[model samples]
Target: MQAEIGTPEAVGLSSERLERIVPWMRGYVEAGKLPGLSVTVARRGQVVFSRSAGLRDLARGLPMDDDTIVRIYSMTKPLTSVAILMLYEEGRFQLDDPITRFLPEFRNMRVLVGGSRAKPETVPAERDITFRDLLTHTSGLTYGFMDATLVDRMYREEGVDFQTAETSLADVVAKAAGLPLLAQPGAEWNYSIATDVLGHLVAVISGQPFDAFLRERIIRPLGMVDTDFHVPPEKIARFASNYALGEGGRLTLIDDAREGRYAKPRSVPSGGGGLVSTASDYARFCRFMLGGGALDGVRLLGRKTVALMTANHLRGDLADMGQPRFSESSYSGIGFGLGVSVMLDPAKAQILGTPGEVAWGGAASTAFWIDPAEDLFVILLTQLMPSSTWPIRRELRVLTYAALIE
Candidate 1:
């Protein structure tokens, strides 16, 4: 909300062309593709456009508003990634340093070579899982929900979950450490729970609780007041309900704002996918990143660190990295950076974008992208789960980019 609003024409964008977004968004809501949604765009550090549509709570007849607080889910990964990098700037640890240097539990971790969920084979990891591997998602770790590999099933059986709040982050990460990895560390790029481990690292290295470190070092400093691990009682009214796509393309309420876990305090704040934020709050985040790690005269990271974080760090695109069968991103033309996905070849990715732009989305179809090259960024917030259920992000890129006139 602190962002100064500007006319699209003032920022080298065509207002008339931007209108193309209105009906496109309304059609999604009218067609029941989303419960509700919010979209915000900025060029050169000024808000050029923002819009919201549909219902935040269908049964309550509540409409989605500009201030609706929604679950950002995996979008939390980038914040966690930044948290650890702050420590990296402090010389707390080197990127290549073994994570076992802090959490000894990961020592002698094994990689799943051959197996069934009931009976498995594993080998000692060739090298220790490094901080770099964690940042780039080259870590051998896997998410239980992947359900594609034996190691993923192991995560389920062993209870290595970040989604549920009953288990603390310490407990869940410890569970992951004991389980077999899906690949050798740094050998493959699989979207995994590495950022959750990075959050724990931030705590251990800074001698502060993970959430506290983020709140003090990142959230508060960035002026993102509404961004937090849980929605407070006073803010619950503004929280948007979360929905899952059902059997017949119908929307089903999965979590209600009044009594959902987000409504109260929880033990494990999933650094991977637990934050609740509003359009304005997250726009500040995107602005901070687009501003090269600082905003409102507060610098959280140096210019070089931001550059390193946004640059592609993979051997090739995710396709070359043998990504697991389940990522919302296309395997080609996109590469993993420290915390976000970097555009490698837009032509190959077949999406409308400039190379080197960075982006990531949540499980709820919430997504954001920062184009350093263009000095522009866009954010979409909605309450539809299993983000893959729709192709909203791709279409938004074309609509947003087509409006650019300079």
Candidate 2:
């Protein structure tokens, strides 16, 4: 139902090799590694392999379908990045401009220099954080769940969570500003709440609520009808139950589709990791990225802008940028682009991927990558918490590229 479900051979993929995906998926389901999942592989502009396997709701006897909606988490970053870039294209602000021109909550931001969580030593940032810093995740912002440092603890203590409706985005930014940054702006490439800050920047710059802006501009324009911050009551039936890999290798129910936070509207949507989407719906978004920021004749971004966004903006690979242990990709050869991770060298990363392929994944293990070199893209959707629970993304990469016969 997404693009055209054509034969794999037509797109330089082996039909017989593509069949290997089903058994591999069933292996995970049968082994209790995944409850249900779906994969969409498209070449050029047409889908050559698309399949949904296993059960979406284990208790409800619901099988994973092409339209099943699941929390896409951080995959929401690219959309938010594109939204802000649209404002950039209007000459609203320069990439190097200090973000103090924006909300100004971060005007007095400090960098952590020494001391402990109880009483940390800090120094005023030598330079103001920029829009480019936020886009590249070099803004020194940190997420609460990283749970790795004092800044992260401060975020949690301040209740600066973004994936909830309880706190406003404005309030979260204000709280984040009160804490010391994990690093100096543009000094380190920490995976952080930078995108959430970008979401607030979108609201401030666009004079529109973040969710409203996204729906009116990117989502609706790209035909991602099922992509949103929350699942409406009418569409709750298609919302998959979220699970956590529990002790003894059991699937633990975390969020039920019948009643979850996503069932209600989000007051402050997280640009980093707060959106639900389907395989087909997400495929539409991927098509937009592959089409140079247009889908079906509607262009939201120019070709040069799209190229700039996908190109690696970091000085070098992520490892050289002082990336932390927690990340959506390997640090060795992967590089950070504007809002996505750009593969720099598969040999150095020790992964099977082409250089320049752009990707990002969610906390629930959902992932998508667009490979301009291959004229290909792949989307994987599942509802599992803490993406580190499995090596599926890496394995899926191997399974996928190995099937390309051309």
132: Cα error in model 2, Å:
0.6
Query: Runs in model 2 with CA error above 4 Å?
Result: none
* TM-scores of all candidate predictions against the true structure: 0.98, 0.98
Q: How far out, in Å, is residue 196 in model 1?
A: 0.6
Model 2 steric clash total: 0
TM-score of 1: 0.98
Return the lDDT, model 2, position 228.
95
* Global CA lDDT computed for model 2: 0.90
Per-residue alpha-carbon lDDT of candidate 2 for residues 267-320, written as tens digits (9 for 90 to 100): 779998888999888888888888898888899999889999999999999999
Worst 10 residues of 1 by lDDT: 322-331
